[model samples]
Target: MAGFANLSQAARTWSIGFMEFDPQNAFNNAGAVLRQLSALLVSYSLSFVGAVLLLVIGYLVAGLVERWLNAALAHIHGFDLTLRNFFSKIARYAILVLVFIMVLGQFGVQTASIIAAIGAVGLAIGLALQGTLQNIAAGVMLLVLRPFRIGEDVQVGSIRGTINEIGLFATSLHTSDGLYILAPNSSLWSQPVTNYTRNQTRSNAITVRIKPDADIDQAQRALIRLAQSDSRVLADKTPSASVSEVADDAVTLTLTYWTAVGDFGGTKNDLTKRAKLTLDQQGLSKV
Candidate 1:
């Protein structure tokens, strides 16, 4: 019985010791886990704060740089406004990309790998957007060479309108008939462009047909008088009248005059109407 009691006591003591050790080990493990979690949270919080600061400061600096560049370009003599805006925007975006890389670095991201991936993606995009890239190239050339300017009347391909805006990818035009046109920069650069507003004055040719025997001299004098009386006609360039063609039953009288470019269409219409009226008053009948 004594031996049996001693064995029971030893067993109880071992059970108690095991129970105490397990709880203490569990508490220690819990404490270790909490400590690791706190350290991880602290690391992440610092990284997040750093990233936010970088983003805010970077965006502010980018905007300031863009504005400063624009102002500086505006002061340059003969610099195109479209070019200035394009360059400023490019600068701002470049700065933003740098800031993004820095922010990623704060989070322990590998920047070299990211740059390589971006390059690969960029190559794919460039291949996919060949036409778009061409337009951008053409746009750069256009801005630098200045074939046409904003608010100028120009005709390219089948499009005719006043230039509303010029951008890196396309050109906007406002037509005389109240329509808007967006033309790709590549097409404009490749095709021939007709600029109507480049010249201060434009020549207008007005032809009137009268009866072959119906006083050619009188008809000529009447046309010349009509052109000269018009205020839109250039005073320095005197109107000239000549017999261009002599048909069987009709004589063609050509009146050439110079007028302000803006007034060319209206002046031509008015002169033709007046010429017809003048010939009727002179008893000249049309063929």
Candidate 2:
């Protein structure tokens, strides 16, 4: 019986000892975990703050660099505004991308892995956007080669318009009839482009028909006088009149003249109207 009583008491004492030891051990472990968590939080907080500061500084620098690059490019002769802006924006975005990579590094990201992943994504995107990429490439070539400038009249394939804007993927144009057109850069670049106003002077002709009985020499003289009266006509080219066709019903006289490109339209229109009136006054035509 004494042995049994001692065993019961010892069992109780062991249970109490375990209860007390477990609580103290648990509390120590919890304290240690909290301390580690707090340290990590403080360190991460500092890194995050630093990263934000770096990003802000990077953005400011990017803006300044873009502006500086634009200004520098402006001095080069034949360097277009579109190209300058495009290159400047490229520089700015490159800086931002680098800053983004650096920011990720602060958070323990592997830059090499990131770059590889980005390259993979870029390749996939390039494959998916083949047509868009082609347009962009064509736009770059157009901007570099300068086939036409803004406000210049150009004809591409069946499209005829004045260049409004040249973008990274498309070119905007205003048609002669006041219609707006957005054409892919690839379309413009791939086709033969005819720039009407690129040259200083352009030759234009006006043909007038006179009655069959009308004196051919008199009609020619009248047409030449009409061309010469216009100040827009280039005196250096020396206006000439030729007999285009001699038919039983009527005789056709062709007046060829050179004028400044800017005034070509007005000069042609004026000469055409004056030629018709002058022929009528000279009794050269019935209608």
Stretches of candidate 1 off by over 4 Å are 1-64, 77-82, 96-115
lDDT of each: 0.92, 0.93
| Candidate 2 global TM-score | 0.71
Q: Which ten residues in a row have the lowest lDDT in candidate 1?
A: 278-287
User: Candidate 1 on 162-248: residue-level lDDT in tens?
Assistant: 999889999999999999899999999999899998888999998989987888888888889888999999989999999999989
| RMSD in Å for all candidates | 6.6, 5.7
| Model 2: how far residue 126 lies from native, Å | 1.4
The window of 10 residues in a row where model 2 has the poorest summed lDDT is: 17-26
Model 2 has an lDDT value of 0.93
Candidate 2 Cα misplacement greater than 4 A, ranges = 1-61, 99-110, 211-214
